[model samples]
Target: MAEAAPERVYTEQEVEAYLGENLPHWKLERGWIRRTYRTHSWKSTLMVVNTVGHLAEAAWHHPDITASYAWVEVRLATHSAKGITDKDFALARKIEDVVCWQPGREGGPLEGTPAGDPRFAYIKYDKT
Candidate 1:
């Protein structure tokens, strides 16, 4: 059975407390929980992006991702509610679970293989 989402409105205290206790790898910024990552190549970055897409679809909540040749910047915010909500917190947690940042780990193929260069491949991550 699917789990019901947390209530839509959370007080500022709730936001702060939840974030403080749960997301050590993410930082609250401009009403969003933000993180940045760089991959070995553009292909890896795209792979991470597609993985995030699947996650967003499954969660029915999305984040803001900026992917470039070698880096991906992710920002999660719940604009509809005007502040961070449980959904934002949930997504941030899920995202943190899937992005890796080992300094020299080659995520996989470079830009031209059949797998193609993703520039966004998602992997599990921790405080780097």
Candidate 2:
């Protein structure tokens, strides 16, 4: 079997450019790309953590996560490559897509959590 090639490590400038164009909510800090998701409560925070954990496990690229009663922060870096890489960006994109999805806005069957009802509220979706 052939070994895979080394992943390319992105420079600070490159990371910044990608974040600006594709991931406006994510930022570069201390060689890691980070994003903080605000949730409605502790239950929502755990949901976010578990969602991210599943995604990271499936992708085989993990991130450092911090969670409080109302927020979850995810930080990604390529530890093996010693810097940010494509994997970090890819995982970040997937996380953002799943976490920020609002089915109600798409006119789909899933009405999404009722924003007005605190009982069903989960993530605090950012207004466009």
Candidate 3:
């Protein structure tokens, strides 16, 4: 029987190149990949968390998730590698697909926010 090759820790240049033109919503932070999904209410927050939980379980790669009334922040890294790896990016892409899904909207993504959606307006990240 052959043993599986160990996963290599990604160089910053390799990671950046892989992201290419479609950066999605993830950001690199201190060796981790992080993203925060802001929702309109507690229900939406719970939905995101639950969906992520299921996906992570199936992927066998878990993330540090912080859930709040109007947001769910996820931080992903390959803990075994002590840094980000392909697994983090793969899972991040899956999460983004779930986030953009629209169950009954004819395949288009769900609307983001209205002109004055308070939940979207108050997040300080919005300023940047």
TM-scores, in order shown? Answer: 0.66, 0.97, 0.75
Candidate No. with top lDDT: 2
Candidate 2 is scored at a TM of 0.97
Better of 1 and 3 by lDDT: 3
Count of clashing residue pairs in every prediction: 21, 0, 0
Worst lDDT run of 10 residues, candidate 2, spans: 108-117
- Could you tell me which residue pairs clash in candidate 3? none
For model 2, what is the error of residue 116's alpha carbon versus the real structure, in angstroms, after optimal superposition? 0.6
TM-score of predicted structure 3: 0.75
Clashing residue pairs in candidate 2 are none
lDDT of predicted model 2: 0.96
Residue 90 of model 2 has an lDDT of 97
List model 1 lDDT by residue over 86-105, tens digit each: 78888878876665434445
Question: Which one wins on TM-score?
Answer: 2
Give model 2 RMSD, 1 decimal: 0.8
Off by over 4 Å in 1: 1-17, 101-128
Q: Please give the distance, in angstroms, between residue 6's alpha carbon in candidate 3 and its true position after superposition.
A: 1.4
Return the lDDT, model 3, position 39.
Answer: 74
Candidate 2 on 1-128: residue-level lDDT in tens? 99999999999999999999999999999989999999999999999999999999999999999999999999999999999999999999999999999999999789888778989989988776
For candidate 3, which ten residues in a row score worst on lDDT?
119-128
